[model samples]
Target: MTNEFVLEAITREFPESVLLSSEPYGMLTVEIKKDDIKKVIHYLKDSSLEINFLTDICGIHYPEHPAQEIGVVYHLHNMMTNFRIRLKAFMTREDTEIDSLTDLYAGANWMERETFDFYGIKFKGHPDLRPILNMEDLGYHPMLKEYKLEDGTRTDKNDAMFGR
Candidate 1:
């Protein structure tokens, strides 16, 4: 099943937030408004979508274009249909806070922690919003383009061509 009914419901609920919807392949990609991310996430999980599993969440920082500050990717899996729905949340440093999905998916505990750890995003409701992989003292967000060193060591394609 393509879950058109679920998609319809989401479309009606978040007409503006939903950036793309492909019914043919049973795929729905929604760009969630920062404040409404949890609303859409809960709907997708509780609704007929059966997207119980929160597979992953990743943060993207594009310093080159200030318009794209933080992009959070959510991978949701529908166990019943074995289909996946991708939800995205684009935020900027000025607005680095987003609703927490921990209540919807218990598994999001670690993923959200990791996202906060690296990208410096704040999960509003995360019980213990702390670093997961990085050390406690690590203050800077190394993933951001602004963290790149003047030495240009972060991006050196020459290593691949020189073979050393």
Candidate 2:
């Protein structure tokens, strides 16, 4: 139930799938190879660790890192012991698709959709992959770093009033 124990179990189970690992803020965070993410998560769920809760799934865009420009982060929790862990997988911009976890965790359906809606990271095998919070015609992933943080053309509001 300890972080070290869980980390050791995962490393032992999949030696090559783990790219990097760390314990930040006392939480075990592991960066896994993109292709093996689904397999790694499957092991964590079905193994003795009993880490069964799927807390969240989200996407990240690191524009500066060409080889690993897009990433997916998964947060899992073990309600029995209140232990938690995080897993991450990254890929290049050209390939933003990753295996869907819906087959493993039913709750992943919406999370994967939301990640796709905001980050354009497709979830392969997702039963219904579409925008959950955004309009279908928006045509772009708003959360990517390439988008501007603010509308520079806006003239209705004065930055002086906001102390900007």
Error of 2 at 38 (Å): 0.7
Candidate 1 Cα deviation (angstroms), residue 58: 1.3
lDDT score, candidate 1: 0.79
Where does model 1 exceed 4 Å of error? 3-6, 20-27, 149-160
TM-score of candidate 2 against the unseen true structure: 0.94
Assess each prediction's global lDDT (C-alpha) against the native. Answer: 0.79, 0.95
Writing each residue's lDDT as its tens digit, candidate 2 over 81-150 gives 9999999999999999999999999999999999999999999999999999999999999999997776
Considering only N, C-alpha and C atoms within 3 Å, which residue pairs clash in candidate 1?
Answer: none
Error of 2 at 37 (Å): 0.6
lDDT of 1 by residue, 1-164 (tens): 45576677788988877766553355667677777778888887787666778889989887665665788988888887887777887877788888788887788889989989988988888999989999989888778767544455657556567676
| Per-prediction tally of clashes | 0, 0
Model 1 residue 80 CA deviation in Å: 1.2
